[model samples]
Target chain A: MKWFEYQMEVDQLHASDALKARLLAMQPDSQTSRDHSAPAQRGRAIRFPHWRRWAAGAAACAAVAVVGSQVLLGMGPAGAGISTMSMTAGGAASSTAAAYDAAAPEAAAYSLAENGLSARSAAGADSAVAGEKIIYTARLTLETKDYDAARAALEQALAAAGGWMENSSESPYDNRRSLSMTLRVPADSYEAFLAAAGETASVVNRSEQADDVTAQYTDVAGRIANLEGQRDRLRELQAGADTLADLLDIEAQLSDVQYQLESWQGQLDWYDDQIASCTVTVDLREVETYTPTGETFLERLGAAFAEGWQNFVLGLAAVAVALAGLWPVVLLVAAAAVAAALVLRRRRRR
Target chain B: MWRVSQEELYRIAVENYSDSVYRAAAHHCTNPIDAEDVVQDVYEKLLRRKGSFSSEEHLKAWLLRVAINRCHDLSRAASQKDVPLEETMPAPPAADHSVLDAVRALPEQYRNAIYLHYFEGYTAAEIGRLLGAPTNTVLSWLHRGRALLHTMLQEEIEDEMV
Candidate 1:
């Protein structure tokens, strides 16, 4: 038989009607029936097996449990560790105090020796050297009944103490007149200037601070000495160079050493400027009556309530914005729910 | 996309595609019982599918692809016991038994390609897409299947004449 004849014969082949009817009568399995209850469930069922999904969920939960346990283990000993650290810190503090006490007499002797040594140094010979570098600053906030008399008295006191006004501002507002000035004085006269300035006005607040920069000054001095020594050695090497390359190499080393020396010199100059002058900020206010600026308890409570209400409104607006962004998703879910309900209702009618 | 309810869609799919799926599965499975199982499985897959078909042709193509895959899975199952094809397969009508037997005697791949091409009237390209093979491979299978069928049927005819 020809190919077309064979094709025609095979095309006539089919299953019996009884067998087709039997297959048509078959219903889905129990698991499939449960899946058919919801469209989302049906989609999930086709995606993966139930056991695989359960295994994935279990793995995720196990990971979370592991991480949580690790966090708990880390935090559990933190309290004990803090107490232990505090005890160690206290022990270190006592030891430091003992060491400071033992070294007190030696420190005094060293200061005297350093004063003698600095008197002979080039920078110290030009200006009187203190035993240690200290930047003294004082802030005096005063209330005065007579603004002009207090200001004149302060200027006289500043001149007598060998101090100059670095900055001065006078403000006349409403009924009050205030004068604020920053004064720079010789370090040796800082105490005398402060005492005299205190006498010129009724001192309401007085604060003095002394920052000792002896250690920083000594460190910079040592670095400068080291760099100078290197520069001298490079100069000797440059004098003895036999070849052009050797001379060039020595010159580069000398240039680098010189640059470092200049940088250290600049830092030393800044330290000298700070140490030579003591800064004093004096605020003299002319007051007709004394009025406190501190807020009462009732005022604080009212402010807190206002802040809380503002935060609540901001939270509500944030939620409204988030809901607006998700409107499309919300609409899709609503449509799905309605379709599911219709399917369920039709099944009931059937 | 289908606008009908899921139940109505399912009924329509079964009414339209059940016989064709069963016939194709019977060609592969050899046994009527296994073929029916395959038919049921294919329908179950269809019912659970989340997507809707673009057209009736698309739905038919999906059903045929799924039916072929189910038949392949059944054939490869470790627990499957080989039943004698002559005993388990229902005899075709007396006029067509010889030709049917000859067609069934071809190798599994050629038998599937031949059945899809000749019996279902699918082109080689369509059969290749359904079977997840290249079109040229389906064409080769068809050539070999036809050669084998012609030889087998001719020998049977010669024997009957003798």
Candidate 2:
């Protein structure tokens, strides 16, 4: 035989005819055969009645309307409320919005007033400027076995530093007491106040914030001054002889300008009080029981089992409720899906 | 005069040409099951159509066209599903298998031409009609397949010589 013929023979041997025969004999799965025949019979059965279809369409429209109306309501005028809240001082004293640090106090206050305004405005909230006095607040948390001793030390420290408790709360359940107060210690006595408060508590956590409202205060004062000047001019015009209509108009304008001047003065005075007093929030945790007890392995295992059972039951209930709520939609969608699947299978067979 | 219902004609067509169609499809599909499926599908198509053909040649061409189309369809569908090629193909008949094996091992275009020309005894023109290719193209595929076979056989002979 030629070289070509010999190679052909070998290749012919390696290529198994049995494999092809076996492949030919293979049949489509029973499921596929059944699925192929399924759609030809009941595709007409699952369709909804005309009235039901109309009802479904109406329901769908109603659902869309309800959602649209809800979104509109949420965005309407009622949604607009106070955009910002300002905490102002009660007196003319400049209240520092910032904690007093040893560096250039005036420069720090200036940057704070400008930067604070920008930051608050960026946050879509109103920003207030404080006067020259910087209010520094420190919160002290203490956990002590000797509550009376801790209280006595704190009181003495506050008295020595001219700091007093503004508010105090005691929880009966745990014997845990907390005190929150604004301390109006002079600028020089701030360190002393901190040290005194530190002696009463273990000083678990402390945070101090500084706010500069000088620019805001000055702006308000300047506005009040300008409005007063305008009001004065209006009054002078009122004193001079003028037409009745002009007098009424001038009086109205003067009232408006006076109202603005009063508003500015009110804002300026509030900022002044904020600078004068330092407000601090303190939380104290009492060590009522410090003894630690070990749990047995069985006890821990039982707890884990209980937790697992509780979670499983809750999960099952939630799933059941969800399925119940969605059963109508699920059934309709599933019927459509199954019908589509059967049709596709039959098409493939052909 | 011979008379047969359209259904009988369909049955007759299936019985007579199904195996042939399967063999033709098997050459391309490399899988016996897929070949059988292609044959069945071809018969189904024949049954679906109005009973009309000018001659046996036309009928056979129609069956061949359906078989070839089905084979290609099966190949494409299998590729989309990332199915293993071996699953759809059956083992070729064990006895006298070497011929079929050698025929199938050829490239897809080459194998189809050689199978139709040699196994089915189709001229290049007839293959062109069935394959929807130009006669010259069918001839080229046959020529190239033969050349490749010759080279491969030659290599085998050298291996035996060693």
Candidate 3:
């Protein structure tokens, strides 16, 4: 009744010689037959035909050609006509002055042309603000004796500077009474707001950054204009389509172009919003007593050790939860290792 | 890049591994015809795979895994009906009938474990990896399978004596 003896018995039972020969005789050509039949069954599930794809591609290329011509024409002397519709400096100058009177003298001479947008300074008269769209951001960390009073003062400062809080959070832990807020203010008031915020609490840290996004914004705007022209051309083609297949093909192109236009339009709107407002991050914390900046080396070492122990316990808990989730797989692997070791040991003994 | 033509590679694979794949499929399938279908399916998949094997052992393991999966798929197919083993296969010679019948009558999982462990000489862990079961589960299958086979064979011998 030994398993090895029974293994011998079963090993003797195999496919008949005829079946073995037949299986071995199978050729790779059988796959060709299956492949040929598979497409026929799959064709019903396919939405687009070969000819339809080619037709759609051709229509797209034609629309692109039309849009390309329009962009080229607009960039030439005829571009003045396109610029006149959106870039009347007189109206923009007045609006800019009304928005922020402090920067009015600089905005009065701003102009938009084929190259890009630029601003001319009145006092220097020779100096010109280069054609660059700059987004400004400021980070301010403050320490105050009263967290609530500091937070209230910061909100009032934002309102006075024509800014709105974009996001805000208060720490839930009792040991650390802190408030964090992100505010969006008119670009002209960015420095003024930072100065006002400094009055609310003692400034512990301050950082300012300016990012140039002129090229990206201009590229997205140009793409949106091109896609809009393409959509219009596709609509015209749809009107001229005579056959059902031609109509469907044109409609598909129209749908695709419209989707692209909407996506680029969203990007343009985002750029406009970002360019109009500067971001200011404020961090306020309550400090009971003012402590000197200097600390002993031993004190720093003790703090480091405490932080390390906390992280170690947190890491151990994470590992325990992960292992609990994969217990079945763990058991299988453990059993496999034990079985493999036993098999190797038995082989050696023999 | 493969130096050999696809046709040449297909020929070499069939010549080298077709019998082993067919035997594995036959152990699980209800009849020879179904087993043949599983064999064809496995070979077809092998031909269509885009990746090249690292070595001969890798190729053999791939073929066995695919053959086992194809057998499972064929057995589970709702359109497939069980055919009598005698109808699909010619009667075994008198000497091998007792053992063949007993092996074939065992449950599918136990039969696969026994065939792979003993006939193929695979260790329990290797069989576990192939069947996607724990090593202990495979060992349990082998143990219960042997106990069942011993009882069946012993009963047959006693009947013959009677």
- Top candidate on lDDT is 1
lDDT of 3 by residue, A104-175 (tens): 333333322311435333453332233445566677778787777888899999998999999998885544
Lowest-scoring 10 consecutive residues by lDDT in candidate 1 chain A? A37-46
Q: What is candidate 3's local distance difference test score?
A: 0.65
Q: What TM-score would every model get versus the actual structure?
A: 0.33, 0.33, 0.36
Could you arrange the candidates by DockQ from highest to lowest? 1, 3, 2
Q: DockQ of candidate 3?
A: 0.08
Candidate 2, DockQ score (0 to 1): 0.03
Candidate 3's TM-score reads 0.36
In Å, residue B9's CA in model 3 sits off its true spot by 4.2
Runs off by more than 4 Å, candidate 2: A1-98, A103-133, A163-165, A174-188, A288-350, B1-162
Looking at model 3 chain A, report the run of 10 residues with the lowest lDDT sum. A37-46
- Clash pairs, candidate 1, are none
| Model 1 global lDDT (CA atoms, 0 to 1) | 0.66
lDDT value for candidate 2?
0.57
Q: Write the per-residue lDDT of candidate 1 for residues A100-176, one digit (tens) a residue.
A: 23224344334334333332232332223345565556787877878889999999988988889999999997457
Categorize the docking of model 3: incorrect
TM-score of chain B of 2: 0.77
DockQ, every prediction: 0.11, 0.03, 0.08
